[model samples]
Target: MSRAEQPSRRTVLAAVAATAVAAPAVAGGAAPAVAAPGGSSASGATGESGSRRRRPAGQVDHRAWASFRDWRSGTAQGTRAVPGRRPGIAIAAPAGTLDYTDPHTGTTAPWEYAVWTSPVHRLAVPATEVIASWNAETPAGTWIQVELRGTYSDGTDTPWYVMGRWAAGDQDIRRTSVDGQGDGRSSVWTDTFAIDDAATGLRLVACRLRLTLHRRPGTGATPVVRRLGAMGSDIPDRFTVPASVPRLARELVVPRYSQEIHKGRYPEYDNGGEAWCSPTSSQMIIEYWGGRLTEEQLAWVDPSYDDPQVCHAARYTFDHEYAGCGNWPFNAAYAATFRGLQSVVTRLGSLTDLERLIAAGIPVITSQSFLEEELTGAGYGTSGHLMTVIGFTADGDVIANDPASPGNEAVRRVYRRREWENIWLRTKRYNASGKVVSGTGGVCYLYFPAHPSLRQRLALAAVGVR
Candidate 1:
């Protein structure tokens, strides 16, 4: 479908304006409750410590990019292979061709791709992860592959790195999953490739990305790409906090959804339910604001599934290269593709800052590593996992839509606020067996509707949300 003809899949809900109200601080806390304009105040008492408080909204440092080339302007170099093909950043004749064989199915079909060398993006701020993300749709045998390289301060570029090939149910670039012709169909998918210096042996000081889209020749299925971009962040390995820090709010309420309930329903998408935390969390917030996939949009999914959109989300966000849908920027980028929404990946400094976002009605998807004992009631543990920060409890505990739960009804549960903070904000954690597990300090994905209020804008600005 053409950009103008793409179906609207969800009902539009009015954006909630932030409310400003003074929240009472804990008896000996150092930081006062600073609510965003129009943001709601938390009913719980705030915590205090001599640690540095969160920076004012405007002073926080972060960065995000929505697209690599101007699609509407045709600035990106590529052919308009088919009529009704969206104008910008599409693959066509000359640069892209349709004569390639599907690696998974061996089916030949018409295929095309566009290549762009992005303007040098400077990562002046030290960053640990370079995330390459894009939005696109391809037919049964088509797919997208993204590669990235970094320019260091010395003006040297690293070797091109394959981010991933986003085809149906493909594995990570290293090919860990069993390869196959996945649920032969076409759908928009978003994915991210993380660049860590420790693994790549290159300092990601500055960078650029290369994208290639492919399809089976003569099939007549045209690949549609709407947006492509990259995000870089230097989240610390560990967060430092004083011995005692107070809570930020009494309670805030966000919606809930679980991934465990759908386990084994769609193995093609990362063995089905076990690997869908990212998309499940994304779906909860999307539905919270009245967003949903229409029956037509989800028609590709098997009807036996209960929440087809979750299945759709898993397939749409599946990273052929990574073999998982939990790519950070990809999840945020996927949320951005929906009408009325925008998203970005950044790190929060403290729970105090997180409370500010919750107060402003924005739910946060956070990455953490924890042992079962470290996080009580979670029922399971992981080396790395994602969960939604929907609200805080009366005692400042965390209320979230933990998809790891066995069922949807049990998705919303509270964790000890401080313990949750340690797992969330601090990077170092222990696994269930008390083995030391390093972390990605305070990294989170923030998504919300566009045209935010001033305070909402401030909250977004603090996280470098564009």
Candidate 2:
């Protein structure tokens, strides 16, 4: 969907956590409904399915992906299977669907796909292979740029690999282009590095790497892209994650209605026209899980410390920026800490990183701008303000709790998802410091480049929460 439609998209997400899976749609021709490979019925399998599914070692699974066959079609449709020559094996059709099935759950959900081969022949990669391969032809007359960066044990000075070409013919990926030797820029180095692969027993700098694929602007043929998280040569088991549960919610401040005054009705004012538009939305998610800082009791906004104030200073503090308030720690910190918490706030830098986390079953929290007028209404306030919304109402309305409000009554405001998202456009708020802070003059988002150790801590904390 166009960026214009994110609000409507996120509204569906706000309430997914509480809702159960709807009954599966029976497709056109119902094959004799045999029990899925495992003795359990398809219905039964879904019962066992939580937000995530387990995968076997060494195999690549594509099921559970939120696929968009037609970029224009905002909503993802059911899977289409491409059967393999081998019995009980097939590649999912309808483009982008997975071809594998769960041996435990006989029923195969259309979204769950696996890439498999004839029982006799197979594709395998060593845990240490520095190459990648695909049967699909390279987009002819085009360049597919691959970047390699790994984190050495000390967790500093990560470097980019030397430029390499996807050589003419299809060959098993044997080696990575040599390291592009030079004192690389710190931003590139920090993002590309991985944790030491051999570390075990709670490594603070444990294994983590990011592989980004950019669609070369003038590539003649459509590039067929495949990625599964792995280090050097080992391909880690890839799985699909539903997008609804983990999401970003933006509390839009539109003009006229959501005003930004040099001196607004509230105290602790900035030179301001509203601020905290996106930060408010993000804080709602982070604090939702930690369950601190009730709405009625306003936390003190510390000018010195840019982060939120936890109930117990010992537990957490306003001094440090955290990834988000939600249980999902798909933030720059990867865990909740002063270290990496600052990195998760941007709409741009966090885009790809957030996508990878979401693909791995973590929800990302972000806000959208629907119309331009909403900002005027939400007056800019330096006073601490935040709320949490667990889900939506029966009529696709946003059901949220304003910690600023009273008990049980916390569930008062219900908004049309589109209406809420529409508000983002009017306000200009940037993410900065630990929380969303305002500019001396107008609103804008803030960004910071964090260290790898900070990110590792955040990731661990996020995963640990669930």
Candidate 3:
């Protein structure tokens, strides 16, 4: 599970070579603005720092630590903030070592570790749920753990819950999300930390993230964390969300690769590619940003296989505990491992946010679930699925690169805007079995160049990412 370099497959990857983050940042002019969650216009707007707000902010609030200043702002114990094109924190010296028994494999080993705790960030929108994500590179003998502690509206604090214990390679440890973590009032549902009784009006008013970087005892190797953040939202519990009027007509020529093509290819990775919608969608957008796998890096794949990169993605992004490649942050962190790219997991208010990103030449990966009849033209349905939003048709319909297709040739699908939006942004839904279930609530992954264009940064800022 150790990657010297992760490989990827391609159907129509762009020829743009990866660029350096130090290359001149194009930022003198005003940041571009996206439609404020319900329209189609690419208009004028400012970043979070600007006094003239782009528009009313959405229900989701994303706060992450990435810049050198942001890294230095955090309280570090055995860690030191490393400054570079992308500022990060690393272990200057180990705080101590502890023996950890693998819950899944039952292998006990001693690991040197260091901790970094972020400054408390009060949520602009007090949320009933919060999901944390981080981007890091863990060497063969190293890994990292992310945890969250929050203060509820009543002023009581929640215990530190382990959000994830992750490694890029599974050689040292199996990447997993800890279960059975809760405080009578709230709980961790796999990757998300949620309030148990949101109807009581209890909400997460603020939270802090704790990052622990782990390495083998007596090794100089360490995990370097480039980005860490979380999304907190209080999406209304409803089967439907207010619909948006699509105003943009544009399409990005993103690559198309299907997860169905690799069904049963690697059963060890979450029962094979049949459930690889997350990684497949990630790989498509990664290639769209000029990220590619070299032949030498792809040496691990079976020569008889087609699109070995998809196989590679599925294997690397697979979460052992979840037994699937659908871990939202794991997929985002996987995409960030590529050269000159940064990725984050956040929520958008509506498809209008998507249109703004597409207009800025960046494609988005969205998570949604639907009944077979809820969506037209999609022959199958699932409790969850991921698709790449490449563009919009002249009629404002969503132009998506759905990896659930039968083959790469049928990957580009046009889903009605209303149907796609409702399925993606709603917080509640009814299953085919006539049971109430949870929806994605606008969760998505945004990947872009480390040094984005003026327009790209503006588009991102407009969506409250800066």
Which numbered prediction scores highest in lDDT against the true structure? 3
Off by over 4 Å in 2: 1-273, 285-287, 290-335, 338-364, 373-389, 400-413, 417-466
Put down candidate 1 lDDT per residue, 1-466, tens digits, no spaces: 2111211110000001001011110011111122222322111111121111223242123332233223332234553423232222445543656454445556554555556444455554534455565555443544666666666544565666665555432321221212221111101122322332233333456666666665555555544554455655555445444323545564445556678777887797778877788899887776665565666667777787787778877876665545577766556655755545556666777787787788877888888766667788887666667888887766777888788887888988888877788877665554444444456567788776544666676665555554
Q: Give the alpha-carbon lDDT of every model.
A: 0.55, 0.24, 0.79
Determine the backbone clash count of candidate 3. Answer: 1
lDDT of 2 by residue, 88-177 (tens): 111223223332222223433322222221111011212212222111113222222334343333445345452232311112111122
TM agreement with the true structure for every prediction: 0.69, 0.25, 0.87
lDDT value, candidate 2, whole model:
0.24
Best by TM-score: 3
Candidate 3: give its CA RMSD in angstroms.
11.1
lDDT string, candidate 3, 1-466, tens digits: 2111111110001001101111210011111121112222122332332211223375888777777777777788789999876778998899999999888899999999999998887787899889898888776788999999999998999999999998877777888988768767777767778777676799998888999999998889888898888888888888988888887999999899999989888899977777788999998988887777766556788999999889888887888877778888888888877757778888998889999999999899998888878889888777778899999999999999999899999999999899999999987777665756677788899988766777887888878775
**Candidate 1 vs 2: which has more lDDT:** 1
Candidate ranking under TM-score, highest first, comes to 3, 1, 2
